[model samples]
Each structure stands twice: as C-alpha cells, then as structure tokens.
Target: MQHYQVKSVDTKHFRLTQADTEIGELEYDSWFSFTAEIMLADRTRYAIQPKGFWGTTIEIKD
Candidate 1:
C-alpha cells in the first residue's frame, strides 16, 4: 500500500505529498465536485476528477 500525506492549504485547496515530497494538489470545485492533479514517481502527471455523494470515485483526464 502507498501512503499519502494531505495538507490543507485553505478551504478550497490542499497539497498532496508522499515521503515528504510534493506529488500534487486537490482542489474543491463545489459541494460535490473536485479535481486532483497528481505527479507519479515516474514523473507522469495526471488530472483526476472525483465525483459522488462523497467523491469516492475518480475519472482520469488528460
């Protein structure tokens, strides 16, 4: 399993880090919408859209 650290930047944004290195960001769009920008260890970047009553599912976007 991989461990992630989330630090809140503000009410609408947060920073995602792993092993003390920043990997991405999570931003809230509304009550039930948000976006994630993640950078993998391989150096590939991905944009993810999470949606649901609690934002439990994600869809990858390019």
Candidate 2:
C-alpha cells in the first residue's frame, strides 16, 4: 500500500519525503507552483507559490 511518507511537519507546512529526498509538500492550503529539477529526471520540486493568496492558480515556467 502507498502512504504519504511525511518527513517533516510544522505549523505552516508539511513535507512528504522518500529515498532521503523531498518529493512533495502541503503548505496549509497555500499556493504553489511546479518546479522541476534540471538534473533529476522524473523528479520535481513544488515551492510555495509566492505572493499569492490561497486558491490562486500559478503558471509554470520551463
């Protein structure tokens, strides 16, 4: 079975980590934008979508 492997938790956010690397996060209903690493294939990082309110849609840049 699959589970949300929580690596860290805090008042503002929580992280889901696997294989000693961060895979995803939950920012307490905050905004986020997709971030893909240049070197890592099939891996991406999602940062707190800057300067926006909750439920804001952010466009991704490649």
Candidate 3:
C-alpha cells in the first residue's frame, strides 16, 4: 500500500500527492459549498457534492 497526502494550495484548492508525485487535484466551487471538481493524473474527472444539509454524506459522479 502507498500513502498519499492532501496539501492545501489555498483555501479552495488542493492537491493529492504520493512520493512527491501529483496524483490528482481538487478545487471547490465556492467557500460555502462542498460542490467541486476532481481531476486525476490519468485525465479522469469527477464531480462531488454534499448529499445533505450537514454534508455528512457525499455524492460523487463521473
């Protein structure tokens, strides 16, 4: 198994990396919303959003 790290580039942007290599990135649409886009190194993309008011559950779509 490999370990990954989530590094915050700013308040709304982040990168997922392993062994100093970037695997993916996450960017939030807004400060108050959990809706965002995910882009992987392989070019795969996904959209994620909160399912409920408290955002305890997340819904991910490709």
| Candidate with better lDDT, 2 vs 3 | 3
CA lDDT of each prediction against the hidden true structure: 0.74, 0.46, 0.93
Q: Can you write out model 1's per-residue Cα lDDT over 4-38, one digit (the tens) per residue?
A: 89998887677888899987776666445566565
Indicate which candidate wins on lDDT.
3
Give me the runs in candidate 3 sitting further than 4 Å from their true place: none
RMSD values, in order shown: 3.9, 7.1, 1.3
Alpha-carbon runs more than 4 Å astray in model 2: 1-4, 30-62
Give a tens-digit lDDT track for model 3, residues 21-46: 99999999987778999999999999
Error of 1 at 21 (Å): 0.6
RMSD of model 2, in Å? 7.1
User: Order of candidates by lDDT, top first?
Assistant: 3, 1, 2
True-structure lDDT of candidate 2: 0.46
**TM-score for each predicted model, relative to the true structure:** 0.52, 0.35, 0.87
The CA lDDT at 43 in model 1 is: 65
